[model samples]
Every structure is written in C-alpha cells, then in structure tokens.
Target chain A: MAYTVEGKGPSHIGIRMSNDAPPSHKEEARAQAEEALFGFWVFLMSDLIIFSMLFATYATMTHALAGGPGPKQLFDIHSAALETIALLLSSFTCGLATLYMRYDGSVKKTLLWFVVTLLLGAVFLSLELHDFIAMAAKGGVPSRSGWLSASWALIGTHGLHVTTGCIWLLIMFAQVAKFGLDPLVQTRFMRLALFWHFLDVVWIGIFSIVYLLGVIS
Target chain B: MSADPRRERRQELHGYIAGLCLALILSAIPFAAVMTGALPRAGIVWTIAIAALCQVMVHFRLFLHIDLSRSHRDDLQLILFSLLIVVLMVGGTLWVLGNQRAMMG
Candidate 1:
C-alpha cells in the first residue's frame, strides 16, 4: 500500500502551512472591527440626536413644579447608586468580554463574559423600572406635573433604550451560539459592544445632570 | 510583577478599571451625603458633574484609546466633533428652555 500521512502530500501544500500563518487572528479581528466601528459611530450620531431632543424636553420643564415630586424628592441617591454600579460594572464586564475576544480568542470565555454583561444590564434596567413603578404608585404619573412629564419622557426614553438593548442582546447571543464567532457575528458583537458602552456613558451624564444636579437646588 | 511590553492593551484595560473605580468612588461620596441629608442637593450635582468629567476622560483615553497616536489622531477628531455637537444640543436646550421657564414665571 502507498504511504500517505493523511495531512502531507503535494496536493496539501495550500492546506497546511504554519510558518507565517497569514494575518494573525488579532489582526483579522481588528481589521473586521474597523468597519463595525465606523458603522457604530454613525449609529451613535443618530442616537445623539434622539438624546438631544429628550434633553431639550427635560430642560424645558425642569423648573415647572405642578403638584408633584421635584427632581430632588424623586431621585434617591441610594437607588441611583445601585443603578450606576450596575451599568458601570456591566460596562467593565463588556470591556472584559471584548478583551477576551481580542486576547484570549476563546469564544467560550467571550460568551461567558457577554452573558455576565447581559445580567448586569438586566439588573440596571430592573432597578430603573422599579423606580418608575414606585413613582407611579406614589401618584407621580406623567399627568401629575410638568416635572413628572419631563421625567417620564427622559427616563422613559432611556428605559426604552435598555429594553431594546436587552432584546437585541438575546438575539446576538443566539446568533453567536449558532455561528461560533463567524466574522459577521463578531462584527455584530463589536457594534453592539460599542453601543452598549456608549449607553453607559450617556447614563453617567444623565445621573450627573439630572439626578445629582436635581438634588442640589 | 511587571507587565510585558507586548501587554500594552492589558495595561490599558487595568488603567481604565482603576479610573472607573476612582470615578465611582468620587460619585459615591456625595451620594452618601445626599441620601443621609448631610449635604445639600447642589453638593450632589457638583460632585457628580466633576466626577463625570473624570469618567469621560477615563472612557476616552483608557478604553477607547483615543490618544494622540498618528493613526488615532483622526479618531480623536471625530470623537471631539461628536462631543461638541452633543454638548451643544444638550447645553443649548438647557439654557434656552430654563430661561424660557424663568421668563414665563
């Protein structure tokens, strides 16, 4: 019988060469991420427009006290603390997930971190909704006051973002599971990561300008 | 142990985590005061605003890597441009709308 080492043959030259190893995995991921980054920046700009409008609405009504709890009365630092920590921790974990993908190149580790990130996101959204529900229970509905109305608009917009993000996260998780870090899946994950982190940034601003500042005067 | 030169990205991530912790700590102190009524509401706002500035820097420099590297110079330009527009939109509305409310009252 002729000898064939299975992987070795003149016909297998293109199939097995391990020296230069064409653009490393890190390089490939970075290259693929470039387009995703550009797209995310565009998306961020569009989101900025939406946020600007919400800010305008809130600013228009900040001083309108119409028989409801004002910002200070409504914003509890303890609660905001929890909300902030949840989002911030999620941001860090998301970063870790990306780092794992970048460094470890272990899809399983990346997915694990992604799940942790999603859990943190869930906690943040839960707390925010709970806060909203509590307010409504206390008769701080949007119809009660201009302040409440603006609060509902601004906070509700942010809440809607979280809701959408959470749904999108589950979809991405499913895709990643089915595809196992295919380039397209990786690109999707990258874009989502940018958007997720961007939301945390916006929330930090929101926590500062709306809640923190509100409590002051 | 010292970090390897090849591990610059690791170092960057570590720095971001530390900066984030600092921002979190700074924000938390006034948070404590506000919840306990040890400080006024204005105190909460100012502290958080300052801390937010720190947090913003931390995100840009550490996480996003928007430093002055030649290749990244272009990214910095875009980031700053986006930031300027966002600030204008948010700040302009606050000024115009707040003043309108004051005038109406």
Candidate 2:
C-alpha cells in the first residue's frame, strides 16, 4: 500500500493506493489514527452539546439573583482577562507541541512545549479557583441564589474540564517519556490536542456570554 | 520526519503562528471593549459575542486543522452538523424558559 500526505493541518488525510494488497504497517497506522480522530471528534461534539445546555441554564438564571450580589458586583474584569490570556496562550502552546510532533518529530521539543502548555493551564486553573474562593467568601457561593448557582455551574464545569485536561497532559508527558513517538502515543497526543482546543472554545463562550455580557447587563 | 520538503514544513508551522496571533487579537478586542467602555453596553455585548463566534471558527480552521480543504471535508461537515444541533438546543432552551418566565410574571 502507498500513502500520500494530503493536508496542512494536524489531521492530515492519508490517501490509500487502489491496488488490492494487504495493508502495510504504515497504512494500518494511518487508518487507526484516522479512526481514533473521528471517534474523538464525536466525543468533543457531545461535549459541546453539554456545554450549550450549561450556557442555556446560565442565561435563564442570569436575573434570578434573589437579592444577592449580581454579576456586575462580583466579576472582576482584570482577573477574567488574566484567566483568558493564560488559557489562550496554553492553547497556542498546545498547537505548537502538536506541530513539533508532526513535522520535526522531536520528542524533546514536543515535550518542552507540552510542559509550557501545562504550566499555562495550571495558572489558569489556579486563578479560576481563586476567583471562586473569593466569591464564596463574599457570600457569593453557588447556593446563594439561582443566579450564583448557574454562574458557578457554568464556570465550574469548564474549570473541571481544565483540571482533567491538566491531568491528561501529565499522563501524556509520562507516555512520551516511556514510549517516545510511537503511533499509539502520537494518536493519544492528537486526541489530547483536540480536547485542549475544545476546552478553549468552551471558555470563549463562557467569557463572552457569561462574563462579558453579565458585566454589561 | 515528514516526507514533505523543508519549505512546506516551515509554511505549516507559520500557519499555527498566524492562528495564535489572530486568536490573541480577537480575545483582546472583547476585553478591551468591555473594560474601556468604548462601546455602549449593548453594543459591547453583541460585538463580543460575534467576535467569540469568529474566534471559534479560527480555532477550528487553524488550531484544530478542521478546514474546508478537500482532505478535511468530512470533519468540516461533522462540525457544521454539530453546530446546528447546538444552535437548536441553545435557542430552544432560551425560548421556552424565557416565555415561561414572562407568562408567570
């Protein structure tokens, strides 16, 4: 079997030869990667649906402050801005890591970039936790009102995803150290890249719809 | 190492950098608009929401590499379909819940 690289992105398609021969190792690996990517894409889409529901719930409860502190009183633009930058930078670093893995195939360089990405992710999570704690201290906990509850649920769900993503990054680090850039390791890295980017996308929604609009309104 | 030529590899890396720059600019716009109050509150909200939508597309095309290019058509189709479902669910929820609140009042 013959393979042709046919794209400029992380998910490059491999064109298969028409000849009727048993699949070679390269062909099998490409097929497996493609299948894994497709499956992961499905998972990300389902995750998107879940986030949409959370946003919907948050929107409905935006005005249900129940005489408690509303968004304008609670959300600090500076902190939110800091959190946004951290996550966006992390997303960019994650992309760089994937590119290094695909183009240069340098495990050390990829791992370096992955570590940076992980650090940025950690910073984002820490800032988010601080924001939550500060809110809770001011009697802005989730149980305060429908508004606060929805706010916590929406932002908390995204934070939970970020936590899991950081754990996934740690696992990837271990895998890369042990297995190098084998096909399985490569496939896992690709999926994690997708997952990381998806979280950033969700954060975009949260910051724009939930925080920015909340402040404006 | 990829079989592609050195020039092609460099170009691919450039794509990622371009994406990063665009995403940063897009994110900064919304934040700036809100903080500076450069626009009215209503305008800022809409502008930020629209910018977020555009940034999502940028992430899809550049970061995740899901594009309209021939090789990635299937992934593109899946994304569009999923987007349709998201729109329906979000829009439906807002509509129903909003109407109920209005009636109750």
Candidate 3:
C-alpha cells in the first residue's frame, strides 16, 4: 500500500522517485522535476501569445463579412455550450488523473481517469467538427469571407492543439502501462496535465470572444 | 503542501471541484445572457468579458495551482509578463485596425 514505487531491477531507475528517495536525493529529484515543470509553463505561455495574436486577428475581422454569413447565422450556441462542457469535464478528469498518479499512486485509477479524459476530449473535438460542418453548409466557409477566415484560423488552431493533446494522452497511456509510475512518466504526465488545462484556459477565451461575442454582437 | 498526504489530496480535490463549479457558473452566465436576450447589447458584452476574465483566473488559481504564495511567485510573474505581452499585442492590433477602418470610412 506504500505509494512509493521502487524500480523493479538493478538499473537504479527508482533512485529518482520524487517522494520516497533518501532526503538529499529526494530534494535533488524534486528540484529537477520542478525545473522541468517550470520550463513547460514557459512553453505554455508562449503558446498563449500565439493564441492571443489569433484572437486579435479574429477581432479585427469580425466586421469584414464580405456579404457572407456572420457569426449569428453561423454559430449555434447550444452546440458551443456542449463543446465547452465536454472540454471542461475533460480538464477536470485530467486533474483527477494527476491526483491518482501522484497521491494514490494507483495505476488503475490513474489510467481510468485518463481514459475518461481522452473520451471527453474526443467528444469536444467531434462537436467542434460538427459545428464547422454545419457552418460550411450555411455558406460560412473561410473562402467566403475575411471574418470566416479569421474565425477558422483561431478556432482551428485550438482544435488542432486539442487533437495533438488527445494523441499525447494515448501515448502517455501506453507509457504508463509499460513503465508503471516511474518518476519520468509522472513528470511527463504533469506536463500533459498542464497542456490540457492550458487548452481549457484558451477555450475560455474562444467561447467568450469568438462564439459568445460572435453570436451576441 | 500539508504534511499529511490525505489532507493534501483532499485539498487538491476540493480545488478542482471548486474550479469546475465556478467555471461552469461563469460559462452559463454569458451563454444565458446571450440566449435569453434579457440584457442590453452592452450588458451582454460586459457580462461575457467579465465572466471570461474571472473564469480564466479560476483556472489558474484552482486547476493550475497558482497563487500569490511565495513558492508560486515565479509562476505568477511569468503569467503577468505574458499578460502584458498579450495586452500590448492584442490591444495594439485593435487600436490600429479600428483607426484604419475609421479613416477609410
């Protein structure tokens, strides 16, 4: 029942366990882990800058409809809300996965939560794709208008990131299965959690500035 | 940060639940404002903006485990710096473009 996972072989892989190593070794490992996590945060902030630029572009193009359909005609609030919920739930489940991995050290519970998170992420992407299809059916294609182009660029970028995250989640699942809860695996999972949660943060901006404001304004 | 793992896990769980609840509420308000059409256009706009800002804060505080505590100072600084860049870039873009549109009109 000890949460500390000892390496199974003579390879000394377990020496880097973040929590259970001898005192000085534990401090060094924890410091390294924190440094790596901080580096990941910096990367997330850079990604934020990219999203902000896209947002600025979308904002400027809102009025350049070029006689094509506008947000009001193209956006369905119900579907957007559903997508928001799916993503939010996925983020919450991701948090749960981290909790299981770090706190309970229960591989079974951690994997279960991650599986749920992946499913929710999939649901969010499907709903987004459906929305795009619906918009195109209504002549809301990016080629039809500057506004549509900007909208597609902004929303499409976020969607692409989510797709990448889903793939990463699957790969992490495989790693977790193969490596168990090694510190390196845990560190990678932490980065993935940060990425996933950061995506939800960006979605806040998207739903608010893009979808909600688009329909309302 | 508590010494007890059980207590720490409980605290983290509470944080996540709180974040999710607040986010859901923040999201619902803007959507409701728009869907119900019960507010003035300006009011709906304000609601959406304010709710979004608050939700973003909630995500950082609760889900990301960021705060003004000394240990989190570095993260807070990084985030603030990023926010400054975003404001400069996004605000400048809007101002310049809006001026151009005004002149063309």
DockQ of each: 0.45, 0.73, 0.87
Query: Considering lDDT, which of the candidate structures 2 and 3 is the better prediction for this target?
Result: 3
Off by over 4 Å in 3: A1-19
Return the TM-score for each candidate structure.
0.83, 0.90, 0.94
TM-score order of candidates, top first: 3, 2, 1
The C-alpha local distance difference test score for the whole of candidate 2 amounts to: 0.83
Candidate 3 lDDT by residue in tens digits, B1-105: 345778878988999999999999999999999999999999999999999999999999999989988767888899999999999999999999999999995
Lowest summed lDDT across 10 adjacent residues in model 3 chain B is found at B1-10
Give the CA lDDT, 0 to 100, for residue A99 in model 2. Answer: 76
lDDT of 2 at B53: 88
The number of the candidate with the highest TM-score is: 3
Question: Which is the winner by lDDT between candidate 1 and candidate 2?
Answer: 2
lDDT of 2 by residue, A1-217 (tens): 1223343232233222112224464465466567768889989999999998989999899879999998888898889999999999999999888777766678888899999999999999999999998888888999999999999999999999999999999988887777666545677788999999999989999999888888888
Would you list the clashing residue pairs of candidate 3?
A: none
Q: What is the lDDT of residue A167 in candidate 2?
A: 96
Chain A TM-scores, one per candidate? 0.84, 0.88, 0.91
Per-residue alpha-carbon lDDT of candidate 3 for residues A1-217, written as tens digits (9 for 90 to 100): 3333343221222222334666656555666677778889999999999999999999999899998999999999999999999999999999999998887778898899999999999999999999999999999998998899999999999999999999999999888777777777888888999999999999999999999989877
Docking class of 3: high
